[model samples]
Target: MSLFSLENKTAVVTGGASGIGEAISKAFAGQGAHVHILEFNAENGERVVGEIKAKGGKAKFHACDVSNNVQVTEIISAIGTQSYINILVNNAGIAHVGNLEGTAEEDMDRIYNVNIKGVYNCMHAVISKMKEKGGVILNMASIASSVGISDRFAYSMSKGAVLTMTYSVAKDYLDNGIRCNSISPARIHTPFVDGFIKKNYPGKEEEMFEKLSKSQPIGRMGKPEEVANLAVYLCSDEASFITGTDFPIDGGYIKLNG
Candidate 1:
């Protein structure tokens, strides 16, 4: 048997309309899983589903705002009615760039709603159902989750919650045949990165990109596919022994940078 094959499994991937989430969704679908994308971007979500279907993979898109518990719950409930959910990738999140002094209360609240509470919302909606037959959950954390990063107070706070949540859920559900974990990626080269550079640095976009890449200590930024590959492995049955862990696909950023 192929160790990483997700054959006959059903995966729900939040934020799957773009970037790392998109890569994970496609990777899971390619591995024979029925992918359900819970995304806020209706157009992108539909397009992704179409692309996956055209490639002969099973996929569906649900327009969902992870911060909205009512909407999230309703969508998950509807999905549960059709398939036995096996995996959930909590990748829906927003980014904020500011230190504590620079961060306003509104910034903190916005980050909290989407990053911290959003993960909770999705996990809460799916846990009881997953308990019935066992499942895997992978949360998209960041290097900010564990270490200090300048100009990222709100983002860091939210990801810290994600890390702890992974541990708490893993411990609480030990007997339920559920495995929970988080992935912390540093400086991934997603379109979001490019856009941030373009909007913030403009003429210095390439300069900023290089600086960000070098910050990782690997002399380059990570690819979304690299993160997705790890997600695929962690979600597969081969990783049944893993739980309550935070895997940093950081290109040595966390350990080597200092």
Candidate 2:
């Protein structure tokens, strides 16, 4: 058998419409898994599914808000009724840029709702189906989960909770054959980054983009596809021996940056 082949498996990917989540959705479908994309952006979600289908891959788009427990549970239940959910990628999270003093109550609450509670909601919805058969859970965490980053208080707090949740779920469901893990990426070059730079830096977008890229020890920002490659391996059967680990695809920022 080909290594990391997900033939006949089913994967549910949150935020699968864009960036790293989009990359993971495509990669999973390319590997023969039937991909269920749960995205708030129906337009992008349908576009992705169409692209996958055009390439002869299996995929379906479901409009969903991961922060809502009832919505998430209902969608997962509908999907589960068709087949066992062999994988779940909790990649639907929003970022906040602010220090403690700069972060208002609503800022913290918004970050908490999407980043922390969203993960909980998706996992909670899918856990029972995973319990029926061995499965994989990959949460998108960040370098902030382990190290300090300026102006990221609320984002950091939510990611820290995600890291611990990975550990807890991995431990709690080991006997049931559920493997849980997280990926901590540093300065991924996504459209969101470009928008952030355009909005904040205005005329100096190039200068600010270069500065952000160079923050990684490797001297560049990471790619969404690179992170997706790692996600594929971790969720594949070849990685059955691994569980509860945090993989840093951070361009050496996690260790060499000091």
Candidate 3:
């Protein structure tokens, strides 16, 4: 059998319309799994599903807001009724760039609702269905989840929750054959990063981009496809012996950056 092949599996990927989530959705489908993309952006969702289909991969898009429990539950339930969900990639999260004093109540609440609670909502909605036939869960954590990143109070807090939730779920569902793991990425090069630089740094976009890229200690930002490749391996049956682990896809940031 080919390594990391997900043939006949049914996978759900939240925020699958863009960035790392988009890469994971395409990769999963390319490996023979039917992908269900849960995304808030209908335009991007349809575009991604179209791209996947164009590549001869099976994919469907569902208009979803991961932060809304009712919506998440209904969507997952409907998908579960149609097919057994063998893999779930919780990649729906938002970022905040602020320290404690810079963070406002609304800012914290917004981060909490999407980053932390969204993970909970999707996992909660799918756990029972996965319990019936065993499945893999991959949460998109961050370097902030483990290390202290300056000016990221709220973002770090939310991701810290994601990291711990991965552990708790992995431990709790072991007997049920559910394997849960998290990927802690450093700076990943995405459209969001470009926009963040353009919005925050203005004319110094190139300067700020280089600064952010070099912060990873490898002199570059990670590619979404690289992270998606790791996601594929972890979700595949070859990784059956692994569980409750946090895989840092940081470019030497976690260990080498001092």
Off by over 4 Å in 2: none
lDDT for model 3 comes to 0.96
Candidate 1: misplaced stretches above 4 Å?
none
lDDT of 1 by residue, 1-258 (tens): 688999999999999989999999999999999999999999999999999999999999999999999999999999999999999999999999999899999999999999999999999999999999899999999999998899999999999999999999999998999999999999999989999999999899888988898887889999999999999999998899999999999999889997
What tens-digit string does per-residue lDDT give for candidate 2 at 78-177?
9999999999999999999999999999999999999999999999999987998779999999999999999999999999999999999999999999
Deviation of model 3 at 239, angstroms: 0.4
Clash pairs (backbone) in predicted model 3: none
User: If ranked by lDDT, best first, what sequence of candidates would result?
Assistant: 3, 1, 2
Question: What clash pairs does model 1 have?
Answer: none
Stretches off by above 4 angstroms in model 3 are none
lDDT of 1 at 75: 97
